[model samples]
Target: MKPEAHYNTGPNELYLDVRLLQNLSGTAKWGKVLAVLGFILSGFILVFGLFMQQMLQSPGRAERVADVGLSGFTIVVYAFVALVYFFPSLYLYNFASGMQQGVQERSRQKVGKAIGKLRVLFKFLVIMLLLFLVLFAISLVMLGTGLSDFSLQ
Candidate 1:
């Protein structure tokens, strides 16, 4: 008699193989660490940006405008870079869950899916990063021109 393969049917009956689950757990841990770091860095950028804007808006603050603007731009760029990975990492997490369930159920469809999905996910991440870079460049240009207040009397 041929043995029946265990398959994870759906959410209610999801199962995960021990080895695969371990691997996924490890992957998730690293990903989570990255997410936390990104969040922290983004927070710093936001706070610094606020401070810069405050300084720029204050009377006689124009004296320091050049340095503050440069620093603010750097912070915004860093935040944008951090955010670039946000959505794609979220997708990767979903894929990891799917993979875990597949392994547990020994589902034929789940076994090799994560590998392909990761490639696609990474591609999307890179594209997002590129988009952020372009937007950042635009922001720098706009800020440079709008804040240019050199006066000659």
Candidate 2:
């Protein structure tokens, strides 16, 4: 095998450098902000869902909601939305914190974990989007079929 032809094909190390660190720092800061905002939004949604009854207690509010076909399940839907929004926020927060720590300490392991979390977040979001898309398509198909059947009758 002729001693394997020793050549230094570089891919062994990645230089972080100051500029890259700065950029990562900026991204981490934004991620933290977005995470915090997401958490707050989820909290607001949960609170609103819980308090939906009280909010709709006024004169015709309940009637209007009922007329719109959102009478009872409003709270459930809002709670579900809030719950769905919370995980991505949590992942973003963890990624941001880990990335910041990694940048500060120049730790590859920390950065890798942070990136892993980001990947998880993206995967989660994409899966959720796909589910929602499918759900929407199914709903539309059902609605169209129902309307056509009604029209035929």
Candidate 3:
């Protein structure tokens, strides 16, 4: 069969342009950065919680494991952080799929298209930032109160 026919026909005759693909790549880049940031922040929070729990439970001991309170905090922090990671990852996947569609539609791209893409990417990034800030604030409040099903101490 024909190569073009195989790659761009029947079940896969997706139509897209270079400008659109560039925009998608820009958005995907933002998504990747956000995903990485969320993962890193989550890791940091988990480690911090572990350390704090160790300190709280171990005045003289040296073993390091989270206490019940800190463990609860870690779980909550991780859950939200996981969510932070999930959205960007989902966006990235959608963006990449869309970009592939654009590629099949148009064989070439340009700088202007890339720049236009950057605009939406930045907007999405800002939204993610706002989300992070709000969640972080909530986490801080929870931490201040201490994570517990019931206060034993």
Better of 2 and 3 by TM-score: 2
By summed lDDT, the worst window of 10 consecutive residues in model 1 runs over 1-10
Residue pair clashes in candidate 3: 23-117
Clashing residue pairs found in predicted model 2: none
Could you give candidate 3's per-residue lDDT for residues 1-153 as a string of tens digits? 776654453433333456865765666566557656655766676666566545656654333434334535655665666556555444444544445444545423432343345455567779989987999999988887785534756
> How far does residue 4 in candidate 1 sit from its true spot (Å)?
7.8
Best by TM-score: 2
Q: Which rank order by TM-score, best down to worst?
A: 2, 1, 3
Q: Give the whole-model CA lDDT for all candidates, comma-separated.
A: 0.63, 0.87, 0.56
Q: What is the lDDT of residue 61 in candidate 3?
A: 35
Off by over 4 Å in 3: 1-9, 60-153
Query: Candidate 2 residues 38-66, lDDT tens each?
Result: 99999999898878856765576877876
Model 3 lDDT vs. the true structure? 0.56
lDDT of 1 by residue, 1-153 (tens): 334355525543445657766876677556556656655665666676667666666677666777556535655665565466455655566566656555566555664575567677788978877987999999999887777743321
